[model samples]
Target: MSHSRFESIGAYLPSKRVTTEELVSQLQETPEFDLERITGVKERRFRDTTPENGEDSFALALKAVQDCLSRSQYAAEDLDVIISCSITRSKDRTKMYMEPSFAGAIARTLGAREDTISFDLSNACAGMMSGVYILDRMIRSGAVKRGIVVSGEAITPIAETAVNEISSKYDLQFASLTVGDSGAAVVLDESVDESDRIHYIELTTASEFSHLCLGMPSDKTAGVALYTDNRKMHNEARFLLWTDTQRNFMEEQGLTFKDEGFDYIIHHQFGAAAIPYMNAIAEREFGHPMPPDLNVIEKYGNTSSTSHFIVLHDQLSQQSIPTGSKVLMIPAASGVVGGFLSTTISSLKV
Candidate 1:
């Protein structure tokens, strides 16, 4: 069986930077908590909505894919699959699309072969990792030679709603204010050796806690909104779902957490405080200190499905993570989903 690895990575952050203070100043009622201190989001990127730019979900995906392809050995015509894992599917200004499938649209735009498999999947913020998992399995099974897992999140509309509707610091919509816009893509193909390959990836969903966070048309507004019970979603038990699942998986393989030898760990950029707390819990549960945590939340906030790849691309771009470093990515998404992805990246570059 062939092991799959990341062949290339790409990310695009909008040029418009909105500071936390600027974002909170729009709130009708001043929040009691320190937004920047709690979220570690001093600023975030807002997509350019100008008619000339047209940087919607589709456009964002296109730009990231272009960047990825620029670094990849394969062209669009050589790709066997394209998976779109974006939660927000806006194609036009505030206009959401579900029909022709974002994957199909991207494939057609990029001029991929007609036989190239294309589809869209949504698993909340775990969407992109879920895409990688599926593609990795497909490659291992020899179902395809190569594929692209891509997401373009134009997710700030929820923040707009939060600014308009939040009544206090305790409002469920408060969490929505942390979101930013971004596009990220990764090309995956068979690995030649263990030095550059995805060792394992797994995801689990605890449906009972699915109600803790939800995105829907606003109950009392003109746009979409996100309602997240951060108190419940970021609790100790909720965080344990990831460590516990990984622990079981490791035991089944006769391995310990430290046996993986990860050089860096990347968590979903939900909040600055929540990540350290999650890592502390992991240390207690796994009986080992975690690898260094990497994140861009202070500048990019939570970019939803694209968060992990964005962090990877950022670190690679800055040459902070060496080529052969093993990285661990943990996903915490709505649907109360949790997962761990371990990989050693060597040839992948942003």
Candidate 2:
């Protein structure tokens, strides 16, 4: 059976952006927290300039899909499946699953066929990658012909909630500054040749660390309340959670950090600090420094599961990645870690 492959990928970020300095200045004026010292984030993206009624995850998803379709020159009707992987969704006045049919709303907005397979996938931060894996398997089995996977993370609400909770509980100043907002989309097709196919994809879960990074809403109607497991909400646990999973994933692939086999390493862009930690771990395990192209955290922050594909799209457009280059996509969600290694055979150039 022939495996399905990704023909093209696209990403869309909101026009409104926030820099760390700006965030710090605003926080300092309020006296609720000192955001400069504690937070590791230097910048983040938001859908709306105003926090109250900012752009929503669904809107961002629409924009991302539109970008992907336009860039790939593929019409919405061409899609056989449309999967939206998101933690944020439209809510009713009572905060219930407003549309219950949110996926249908997305599909209709994009002009997808009435028979198109459309649904939502929720797996914390691993939704995007997980969607890709599922679609790949289905297409390979000839269950689908072409599909689209999209992710939109409107983390601002969660970040704001975290900031308020941490400030009220521990009197901390910089807790909310760490979260970032982002969204991405990828187009998959069974018609693509095998030469451009995904080489290997792997996903693993360490349920033991499930409590390490968690999101709980103080009130069911409110946004997420970020907290750490072990009753110690520190950054160490977050690092350990990601590092441990990454190590296990690499070992499973028989890949040592020292191997320069991959031209680019697209990791979960957690933060600037997380990138160095990943590189250090890779060097120690592989006994050598990671390749130069293995970095994307500095600019995009951590886009959860979309981090890997976002970097993949950016690098492809920058001429930094050449055709037929091998790329490794390593992503870790709250409870799962996934690794996808694929080669670029099609010329991204016009």
Candidate 3:
């Protein structure tokens, strides 16, 4: 079987950035709370109704896709598959769009061939990673030669809803306040060499803990809201969530972390503090220091499925990552979904 790897990546954040202090003013009776110190998010971007850039999720997605193609070896019409995996959807950020399928809509707008397979996938913050997993399988099986897994996240509605509904600093929905609006796209194609291939993509769901976090309509607001049990969902025990399976897989395959040749680990951009914690746990599981963890949460906050790709795009643009680098993309989402993708980015055009 062949391998699949990311060919190019593109991302966009709203021009209007809101500082942590500024966002505090919008919350009700939260004067004692300090978001910047707590989450390490200095500021975050939120999309607004502006002619400069379209405010809707679809518009953001289209722009991101166009930019991704501009950097990739393929054109929009060359994509054999298009997957849209966003936590939120549409111009009306609150209403989820499933009928036309955001993937098909993007393919149509981009003038992809009629034979292009397009659809949407939802896996909480792991949506784009899940899309990548599916496309990897398709490409390796010769079902598709090239594809894109993209997301345009308008998740700030949850924060807006939280600020209005929470009366105290102890609100469970507080995590939602750390999100920003962003769009990210990745162009994936068959790997042409050993160093440019995806070694593995894995996703494991601990559905038993699913009740600890949820996204639903706010009772006091007109927008959607996210509720999370921080104590229950992000405790020391959470490290065991993925390690059990990973340990067994390592033993079964007789493969070690060093053998994987991972130079960096791009984790879910949830918060500034979370990355180190996750790395400590991962290093313990690997019996060695894991690659330096990479993050962009300080500026972009959590953009759900777009988080990993956003960080990747930023790092590459900064030349923080060089060719022939091996990377591990990890996900830590609400479904207690935890997984890792090991790939060599030496082949990614960036």
lDDT by residue (tens digit), candidate 3, 167-187:
886888888889999899998
What does candidate 2 score on TM?
Answer: 0.81
Name the best candidate (by lDDT).
1
Q: After superposition, how far is residue 139 of candidate 2 from its true place, in Å?
A: 1.7
Instruction: Assess candidate 2 and give its lDDT.
Output: 0.65
Displacement of residue 111 (Cα, Å) in model 2 is 1.7
lDDT of 3 at 21: 77
**Better lDDT candidate (2, 3):** 3
**Model 1, range 200-222, lDDT digits (tens) per residue?**
99999999889999999999989
Which sequence of candidate numbers ranks them by lDDT, best first?
A: 1, 3, 2
TM-score of each: 0.99, 0.81, 0.95
- Could you give me the TM-score of model 3 versus the true structure? 0.95
Q: After superposition, how far is residue 297 of candidate 3 from its true place, in Å?
A: 0.8
Candidate 3: pairs in clash: 324-346
